[model samples]
Target: MAQPIIEFKNFGFQYDAQAEPTLYNIDLAIQPGERVLIAGPSGSGKSTIASCINGLIPFSYPGRCTGSLTVDGVDAPNASIFELSKHVGTVLQDPDGQFIGLTVGEDIAFALENQCVAQPEMKQTVERVARLVDVENLLEQEPHALSGGQKQRVSLAGVMVDDVKVLLFDEPLANLDPAAGKQTIELIDQVQQKTGATVIIIEHRLEDVLWRSVDRIVLMGEGRILADTTPEALLAGNQLAENGIREPLYITALKYAGVSLEAEKKPAHVDTLRLTEQDKAAVRTWYQQTVARPQAPAAAPLLEVKDLCFGYSEGVTNLRDVSFTLNEGDMVSIVGRNGAGKSTLAKLICGFETPRSGSVWLNGRNLEGDTIKERAAHIGYVMQNPNQMISQSLIFDEVALGLRTAKLPEDEVERRVNEALTICGLYPFRKWPVSALSFGQKKRVTIASVLVMQPKVLILDEPTAGQDFRHYTEIMEFLRSLNQKGYTVIMVTHDMHLMLEYTSRALVFNQSRMIGDLTPAELLCDSTLVEQAALKETSLFTLAQKCGIQPPEAFVQHFIDYDREVRDKWQTV
Candidate 1:
């Protein structure tokens, strides 16, 4: 029998200088060339399992490891991080912190340099890995200057150059736009096919990547792997959601159609579930009705944009000749390719940046005159990186910071802070030190911090970037509840999944212009517009096509309405 490339036999681990083990008895194995998607909810010990493959647990993290965890032929606990590098290559969640070079080319070469590769051979290796990760065109660019997706691709190239037998990707698509994220997944599939390396991926959005290719899916929660099965079988069960794993929208749709485990034998996964004439007809009829009629465009602008334009530098024009209006209760998504000034536009409308020209009127008040603090009375902006928004050492204090900063009464602060914590799903951990939390938990603290302020409009930048399915739903469900209470939300995101599932309207940005503003179904149907804006048509739509459904409008709209309120924010541009 062929030796397994990665094996975790009844393994458990605890960080050094810590009280309890973070992981307990994780049993997993992967043969050479197998692709496994390791996924679970926030704080599920998913990261801990991936760390063992790279020897990060016992080396950099300093932990007590039990049983056996091996990569290639060596035991992980017995090897230093450097020694394990010979057999394993790791790509971390945050691409910014892993850079070792000023330029993309240099970054990929750094690992090769450390290996003492010949100068001529190193040049060839850099070229080889660049193509492997699809960053060949970015070789001469500065690492810091690249977009979030580009930065991740460069990081992948750095690891691939080493030709390590085992490859581990930790949330590789977290910060990527839909288009880039799909391309990256395709690259992983290509790399595996060509090199036959053992690939293990940890991600929140499984359907977007690793779809039919993943050999197995491991679900974890509260420091243990609760279930291990093929992707299709795992998604077919609602039990995963109970276990803190969020099932994909398409799977949930299957459940709703009476094809669920409760009604019929769950066919392992949606891929193997098999579509029937009735299944196709039921799904098809819904699609035809939705596509035939999408609630007639809403009128009477809620927020008007009169030739609104913004820029950050002398020669660059971020938003040019942008004119549009959003009505009350409109859940709008502002989307664009990387560096198309999507974030810049969010800053302008929210008063973080003063527009160079034109006006963004919110309730008849031009946004330019208001300070971000004054705008906070109506608009709350959640920064993309939660680390930047976090200030207090403890979770409770962090959420209370806005209220405290306003010098609110003790009674008012306590009442409001607790409410926000509960809404953001951080109520139980309110007293926990902020440092003890995972990345997703840190993000929740930031959301709770902003929500306590009670703004009329909320702007979330990449809210679900690092979250798994379960937490993604928790946050969005809260936002939907808030929207029901009359909070207008405008999100700036690269996640088309979030856009489809939550927003009422889309503000498509391309070439530094507000190309078009349309409904989610309209946006997905326009292949040219989606591509121009650097987004891929969602996988649900693609899968529906495979099943021969016309347009898949119902499935597309299912996600759009999942987190919305019925009160129409009916403004279209």
Candidate 2:
């Protein structure tokens, strides 16, 4: 048998500033040419493990370490980051933040150039790695000008040029659209197969990661390794839900239909799952017997956009003839590929950009004359990047900034800010420094900052992007409650499940055009629209088809309705 390329033997680590060890007695091993997924909720210590593997924990983070860890036959804790860099190359969550050169070629060659390699050798190496990542043609383009998926590929090329033995990807799918994300996963598989490199992926999107086969899954929680097993074995159990990780939608659907998840059935991947006659019968019976609740009546229009046309440059359209009405007490999702103008639409409505020849009306009042500040009174926009919105050092101060800016009384400001923090599940950390929080927590802080403004219409851009399923549920449920209380909510997001579960209607955009306006189920069930918008069909649809359920869209909607009913009951309890 081949030796383990990476091994951790009863390892433990504690940050200098932290009171307790973040990782506890972790023992793991990864063989060469293996693909393993590390999954857990926020604060699960999975990131800490990544830091240790990359020689960042004891080096950059300055922590006390116990036990031993090795990567590529070198001791990790005692190794310099530069030494480990030769063996481990990481692609970070935000590909834009990792760019260091002006052009794609320069960025990929930066590491080699730093080593003082000859120009001729460097050029050959850069072209080879760029071709490996399928980015050879994009070498001359500015890294920032590339699309999200293209940027990610550039990031991968930048690392692959090093000829590292292990590839570490930190949440590579977080900012990508569905099609882009799928393509990224496929690219990672191809790169791994050709190079025979060990791959370690740290991600919260378990279902998406499973789109490509993985050798094993390491589930962690509370600073402990909960389970390390094959994906098939892991998905056949309750560890994911117990640890606050979201299982695949189809798995949940199967469980809902009382279909047992036998290991032999291969529940890990939808395409490979071996369904039985009894399982099909069970799903069919459940669908036939289940009664879907009637959808709520449409509310009166509270906001409207007509003939909206916009572009950053003259004669080049980013959004064209786009129009939609947002009714009072409605929750809708705007979904599409990145740069499909979803965020542009939100910006136009919020008065950040003036439409070329369009108008916005709120409550029969023309908002064309409203300034950005004036629009704030009726509309709240929470940006996707928290760093762009946060201006305070502490969480409490940040959340209260909007309220104080409005000249609310100090006592009232405190009341509203605390309430918003509670709703966002950030009240416990209200006194903490903003820099001390995780990316997900910072995202919640931004949401809380907006929630305190008490706008009539709330527009959130990827509100749940960096969050775990637990926090995602909390924020969405709070938004649902707000909708019930007459706040119209619009979410610009790439999360298909969020659209299917939390939203009643979806506006699909593609190529700067509003392509489809329909229910979430209807949008996902139509293959043409799904493909056009770069959206993937929900696994629940595939499950329905496998079970011989007629009109798969109904079954999808029925599952959503039934799931929401159960969730609502749980909330009431």
Flag regions of model 1 displaced more than 4 Å: 16-19, 236-239, 260-274, 282-302, 393-454, 540-551, 558-573
lDDT of 2 by residue, 1-573 (tens): 799999999999999989999999999999999999999998899889999999887988998999999999999999999999999999999999999999999999999989999999999999999989999999999999999999999999998888999999999999999999999999999999999999999998899999999999999999999999999999999999988999999999999889999779999999889999999999988887656586688678899988899999988899999888878888999999988999999999999998988898999899988899889978999887789999999999999997788899999999999898887788899899999987767877887887788788999999888678987887788778778867789999999999999998999999999999999998999999999999999998899889988799999999999898888788889
| Alpha carbon lDDT of each predicted model | 0.77, 0.91
Instruction: Tell me how far the alpha carbon of residue 440 in candidate 1 is from the true structure, in angstroms, after superposition.
Output: 6.1
**What's the true lDDT of residue 218 in model 1?**
83
**Number of the top TM-score candidate:** 2
| Candidate 2 segments exceeding 4 Å error | 292-294, 393-400, 407-445
| TM-score list, all predictions | 0.86, 0.95
> Alpha carbon lDDT of residue 172, candidate 1?
87
Most accurate candidate by lDDT: 2
Q: How many residue pairs clash in each candidate?
A: 8, 0
Model 1 lDDT on a 0 to 1 scale: 0.77
Model 1 TM-score is 0.86
